[model samples]
Target: MSGARAIVEALEREKVEYIFGMPGGATLPFYDALWDSKVKHVLVRHEQLGAHMADAYGRVARRAGVCTGTSGPGATNLVTGIATAFADSSPVVAITGQVAKAMTGRNGFQETDVVGVLTPVTKYTVQPLSAAEIPSAIRKGFYIAETGRPGPVLIDIPKDVQQEEVEMTFPESIQIRGYSPNYPVDVQDIERAADMLARAERPVLFGGGGIRIADAASQFTAIAELLMAPVITTLQGKGTFPEDHPLSLGPIGMHGRAEANRIVQECDLLLAVGVRFSDRSTGNFHEFAPEAKIIHVDTDPTEFNKNKLVDLSVLGDANRALTLLYDALLRRLAKRDENNAWLKHVNQVREELKGIPAYRDSYAELSGPKIVKLMRSILPPEAILTTGVGRHQMWCEIHYKVLRPRTWITSTGLGTMGFGLPAAIGAKLAAPNVPVVDFDGDGSFVMTEQALATAVEERIPVVSIIINDRSLGMVEQWQRLMYNRRFVGIRFQNIPDFVKLAQAYGVQGRLVGSLQEFGDALREGIRSDQPSVVEVPVSHEEDVFPFMPPGKGIKDTVYGTSKEMAVF
Candidate 1:
């Protein structure tokens, strides 16, 4: 078989049904082979979007997201998406077409040292030296991405390599030096951790995107249920705990829920599983959970004891570590200090949390959380939702009833501005039977709204709910709350009507003024067989509660509906 055909066959053997990418000169042979292959090639408007789709699809399906790009600008554009996936530990396989081997490193046309460019962001990166290595390279990429701490991996295929004929034999197994996916934590360590938790009066469960990546929400739920503790999911960790559950403190961080961040701060013991403590989640590190004894469990050793000093650093799969911990805890007698007082106090604090940012009745137009709740009610349980960065994303994080893991996919680590729409397109394609919706801020969408055409051409139906506030609402909120009404370069002035924007892409678009209109528009978008946009114009005055100012702790948040209004 030809090298190109062999590549396609390898992809097929790896169970890759879709490839998100752009055509490039060096990649002509691969595209030609893909022309008749069973694997569908989704031509994205930008290579960046292709990467985003791959990342989103990987997260949603719990498999590797496959994306391709050309040598120079195409490969460069894919960096952010790759970084996002890498940061969140999502499994993605990035295939790039490099210049011919003979022309490498001599300023070859469209050659940009893809391996070097992608190294920092990928778990592994390689440019195959020969056609015979292509199959192995592909297999290694998939294996590295899905096992242990999943992350993006890159394979750069030289133009000459793609043209060389080669035999195709899938690898029976894969091995990488200095890479181990499984870590068995010591039994004594588990017992010691259990003892610490059993002794603590204020214990909290904190989680991150790794929870979803591991597909271990049930294990997390088991721990919480057994301990009767509230959960504070990181922004990336949203949906690990049902947002509406009594123990759920929607996502704690810079813009976390009041009760959640507060509880995390007040806790005596915090068992953070598969969660890297990002600065955004912890806010100012100095003030972060000063009193909590943090037990950190992660697959990556680099993450161990890297952030807050860990009282216990268990190196293993998050699900497995959690399972061990729960089993050990269950085997031991229940702690005598089990009081529902703290739990009840936390629940009451959630109910009466001051500063629950509600808009003035004069501007009765729905706000972010309000719109998110309405949108959630309209979506099916199976329907997946994607998001871009900004206030809208935070609102959805707080209120969206993400019932299960992988239901929410967004750029949590990189905080990329233009990730939502493409991710929705990717999510929709990966699961064509389910409806995919992307709630984007006007500011965030305008950054990569060009992908709408890709969504249209691909027939990937994504309900894009544009929260049009006419400004970067998050920055504006910060300006209002912290900067003393000094709204600087944070406003989006004179934006186009998103409905008409969708129409120009030959896709459907609608605008909503009130709750009734919002419901009707979302209903139509979800039911529509084609791509559509629902522009829900939200009030600029809207704010997400439990906001920790810069240089403040997670506990230093302002509640949405605070009576005193100053203290979090």
Candidate 2:
């Protein structure tokens, strides 16, 4: 069999349903092999979009999503998407075509050291020297990508190698020296953690992306309820626990809920599970959860004490660790403490914070928060929601309710703009029966608007709710608060109407001016058989509040634009 055929066979063995990419000179043989394979190929308009699609697929399916690109520019274009996956710990397998092995160092046309370029953003990168190495390389790539701290893995195959013939035999199991995904949780660690929780007067359960990545949402919820603790999620951890639950405090960090920030700060113990304690989450490291004794649990040992020092650290998969901890806590406790003063105090704070004035938009008709609330009301609880990074994304985070895990996807760690549209398409493909929507800003949408072409061509019917603010909203907000509102290139002259652009790509388009019109458009898009875009124009002056200025602690949160904007 040819090496390219062997690669397809390996993908089949791994049960890869789809491979997203566009063909280039070096990838012809691979594409030719793919023609006869069961693995569906999604031809993206750009390599970056393909990478983002693959990333979202991995997030939704809980497996290694595959993407391919040719040498040089094709591979480089995938960098941002691959980095986004790495930052958020999404499992993705990226295959790029390389020049013939002989021309590697001579800088042949379209040749690039993709392995060197992608090493930092991938868990592993391999270049099969010969056709015989293809099968094992692919198996290891998938294993590394989907195991431990799930991340992207790259496979760079030379054109000559792809054309070479070999007798392929795929290995069922692989063992890489100095690499292990499994970590057994110590009984003593669980017991110690349980004891700490039991003795604490006030405790907060902090969950991150790892919970969803490990499929441990149920275990996380069990532990939270067992302890009668307040649950605060990081941005990446959204939807891991039901937002409507009484114990849920929503997301915490810079744009976190005011009540959540207050509660976390006051808590005596913070049980941080599968979280990295990034700077965005911990405003000023010294001031964050200052009074709390934090117990950090993660599979990656390197993450231990990398950000904030913890009282105890447990190294194990999130599901296994959380399961054991829940069992230990259950065995140790007799009954729920209905009269716990800490719980009552937390509830009181939550209610008190509710009385804080809601952000009043100058243009109430097209308010971001109100629009997001309307979306929540219209979309089913199980619908998958994706967002582009900007003021709009933050608004969705604040107002949109995600009831289940894997239903909410976004570029949290990397904060990549233009991620929503392609991600929504990828998510829709991953879950064909589930409804998918992208809450995108105009600036972000324009960056990857070409994706609508792919959606139309592929017959992926996802709704894109473009929050057309006519500016780079987030950057403009920062300029207003920190740079004296002297905006430079933030605003955009309304050229190329989004509704028309959507129509140009053969997608259903709707221009909504009022809230009712917006609702009607959204519902229409959701019910449509083809890809649709609902363009919602809003004021550029609109800003996402409950803002934590850089270098400030959560206690210094700005609840609205009415509050004094701190110049950091």
Candidate 3:
């Protein structure tokens, strides 16, 4: 058998259903092998979109999504998507074709050191010197990407290696010298954490992406309910806890709900699970949770003291730690403490600021928050949503109600602008029965608008809700507030009509001016059998509020047009 055949056989053994990629010279042999395999090949318009698709697929399916690109430029193009996956801890296996082995160091056409370029962004990077190593490298890549702190892994196979004839022997079980994904949870740490919670008057449960990544949402929720603590999530942690639950305070951080931020600051004990406490989540590390004693539980030991210092740390998988914590806490506490003054106070604060940055009538002119709220009303609870990073993404973060885990997919950690459209495609592929929508800003959408071709060609029926603000909304907002409204190179003068562009790509397109029109368009798009694009023209002056400026604490959140309106 040929090396390419061996690779395909290995992928079949791994049960890889789909491989998102583009074809090129170095990958021709692999593609030939793929043609006769059970694995489906999704040819994308660009390598970057292919990578994003794989990332989203991995995130939604809870498996290692595979993506391939040829050599040099093709491999480099996958960088942004791969980095996005790495940042969010999404499990993805990127297979890039390398130049022939003999072309080493000669700067041959399409020859590049993809392993060196991707090492920083990947959990593991391997370039097999022989075809015999292909199966092991692929098996190990999938294992590494899908285990522990899940992330992307890169496997670069040279052209000669793919063409070389070799017998394939897929490894049933393999071990790496220093690679260990799971750590045993110390019962003493859980006991200490339970003690802290038992004595605490004000306890807050903070959940991050790890909960969803570990498939431990149920465990986290049980712990939160057992302690009757207010639940706050990070951007990547949005869907782990049901947003509409009574105890749910929604996401916290720079653009988080004002109530959540206020509660985090006032809490006495913060039980942070599967969270790394990123700078965005902790506005100012010095002032964040000053009064709270934080007990951090995470799988990665390196994240212990990387950001905000914790009173206690537990090194183990989120599922294991949370499960044990719940069991331990159950033994200590009999029932929810309804008479606790701290719980009453937390509820009072939540009620007081429930209307912060008030929502406009659905009939009024379209705004980011209003649009998202309307979409929520129209779409089913199970519908998945992806977003491009900007003011619009913030709005979705604020208003979109995620009822279940793995439903809210966005570029949270990296804040990649062009992530939405392709992500919607991948998400739809992962969950064909559920509706998938891409809530993207005009600026962000245009960056990867070419993805429409792939969606149309592939018959993916995801809807794209483009917030056409006619400018880089977030940048303009920053300029308006901090730079005296001196906007430069942000506004669009003569841009391509997004509706027309969508139509050109064989997608259903609608240009909506009013809220009713938008709702109509959205409904039509969701019901359509093919991909659709709904372009909504919004004012560039509209900004995402409850804004925390750089170098400021959560207490300094700007609620409305003025700082005086921050506190109600």
State the lDDT of candidate 2 residue by residue for 1-568, as single tens digits. Answer: 8889989999999999999999999999999999889999998999999999999999999899999999999999999999999999999999999999888899889988999999998999999989999999999999999999999999999999999998888999988997898988887988899899888889999999889988899999988887888999998898989999989999888888878888999999999988999888888899999999999889999999998999999889989988998888878885466468988999999888775544343446887898998899999989999999999999887778789999999999999999999999999999999889999999889889999999999999999998988889999999998999899998887557887898899988898989999999888888888999998888888788788888799878888775534321
Quote each prediction's TM-score: 0.94, 0.98, 0.98
Tens-digit per-residue lDDT, 27-115, candidate 3? 99999999889999998989999999999999999998899999999999999999999999999999999999999889999988999
Error of 2 at 266 (Å): 0.2
Model 2 lowest lDDT segment of ten: 355-364
Cα lDDT, model 2, residue 387: 94
Q: Count the backbone clashes (under 3 Å) in each candidate.
A: 10, 0, 0
lDDT of 1 by residue, 1-568 (tens): 7777778988999989899999899889989999889998988888998999999999888899899998899899899999999888889999988899899779967889888888988999977878888888898889989888899999999888999986666787877787778878777878888898888778899988878877788989888888888888888888888877777877888777667777787888998887888888888766777888988878788997677787888777877778889998888755333357778778777777643543222246677777788888888877899999999998877778787777888888888998999999888877889878999999999888989888888777789999998988888987888788888998767899888898999989888888899899888888888988888877787777656777776545555534435443
Pairs that collide in candidate 3 are none
lDDT of 3 at 546: 80
